[model samples]
Target: MSKRGGSRNPSSERARGRDREERREREREREREREREREKRERERETEREREREREREREIEREREIESEREREREREREREREREGERGREGERHWKNRREGHDGEKSGVCVCACTRERERERERERERERERERERERERERERGRERE
Candidate 1:
């Protein structure tokens, strides 16, 4: 004779335990999947940040190169202007040498003309100096802007 509801069935108890374990394992797997997804998102975000940083660096390098090119152009222009001034000086000297063979009155007139020409050249040189100063100021301003960008 068995007790009516006092004894538990062993098979039923084992099946319930197995079902609980399966549910717990499924929950653990879901947690692991969520963690993997989070890690993947973080990796993607880091990659994007690196790419953006690289792009910005490239742009900065390009700007620096452009500034250098502009400075080179300015130097070239100054050199050309100096060469032109030297050629003019050579021409004036040649003229003076020829004037030595002429009469006194003609030589005096040539000297006066040379003096006037020197004064005109001095005035032109002063104007060019002012222009060069302005350009230098502009370059300095650009450098300041680049430094600000760097900062």
Candidate 2:
């Protein structure tokens, strides 16, 4: 039988080339999409890690503030107990001085009053310092939050 057309026809060759080019284009598109997906996943993971870090920092700061508050409260309780003792001592000495008018008892009362005043002033200073620290922490927190855009 005579072959009507050879297997290597020019039109068939052009069509096969076009098919191969089309397949290559589709493969390139798929690769680009996969790369984009991978990049998106990486960015998501990075964001999650950054969020975890910020949360840890916040937790640490809270713990530190709580610890400081506990220490301050302990100091306050101790000061109150000391003040009560001083008051009781002053009253006892006053009664004794009224019985005999001792100059030494009067000097002791003066010293206790001075110490009490000093303690009150120190307490006020400490409160002011604590307030300043809290304000600074708040400002820092605000800055941090503003810098990080939440997801």
Candidate 3:
């Protein structure tokens, strides 16, 4: 009877051990699934961050292109202004040459000389201001380039 009872006891103990092992296996599978989900979420977050960074870079590039266009326009305006001044000077010289050589001493010639002197002084001042503006623009360009590099 004692031997029979001991044999029954081992069989029940083995059944309980198998049930515990199965539960442990199920828990391990759940843990593995959780780990996979966490990794997936982390990868997704990283991908989003990369996309945001690219977007910021594109925006900055667009701004830089716009700024460059504006600078080009400003330079064109400056060139046009200088050309107009040169044209005015040339026209005046031509007028003076024609008037003095072809015509007799005229009142118009006196007025023209006085006007030319005043215009020359004003032109000198404008040229100085233009030079200052050019210097300032060059400095601004250098600074912008540096800022773009940093950003």
Model 1 — which ten-residue stretch has the worst lDDT? 105-114
Q: Write the per-residue lDDT of candidate 1 for residues 1-151, one digit (tens) a residue.
A: 7767888889998999999999999999999999999999999999999999999999999999999999999999998888788773576566654544445555433343456567888999999999999999999999999999999
Model 3 segments more than 4 A misplaced: 1-8, 90-101, 104-151
Q: List the residue pairs that clash in candidate 3.
A: none
Question: What does candidate 2 score on TM?
Answer: 0.55
Q: The CA-based lDDT of model 3 is what?
A: 0.83
Model 1 misplacement above 4 A = 1-5, 90-151
For model 2, residues 40-132, the per-residue Cα lDDT tens digits are 999999999999999999999999999999999999999988878887457655654444423554543333334455688899999999999
In model 1, the Cα lDDT at residue 60 comes to 100
Ranking 2 against 3 by lDDT, winner: 3
Q: What is the C-alpha RMSD of each candidate to the true structure, in Å?
A: 16.6, 20.3, 16.5
Preferred candidate (TM-score higher): 1 or 2? 2
> Considering every candidate listed, which one attains the maximal lDDT?
1
State the local distance difference test value for candidate 1: 0.85
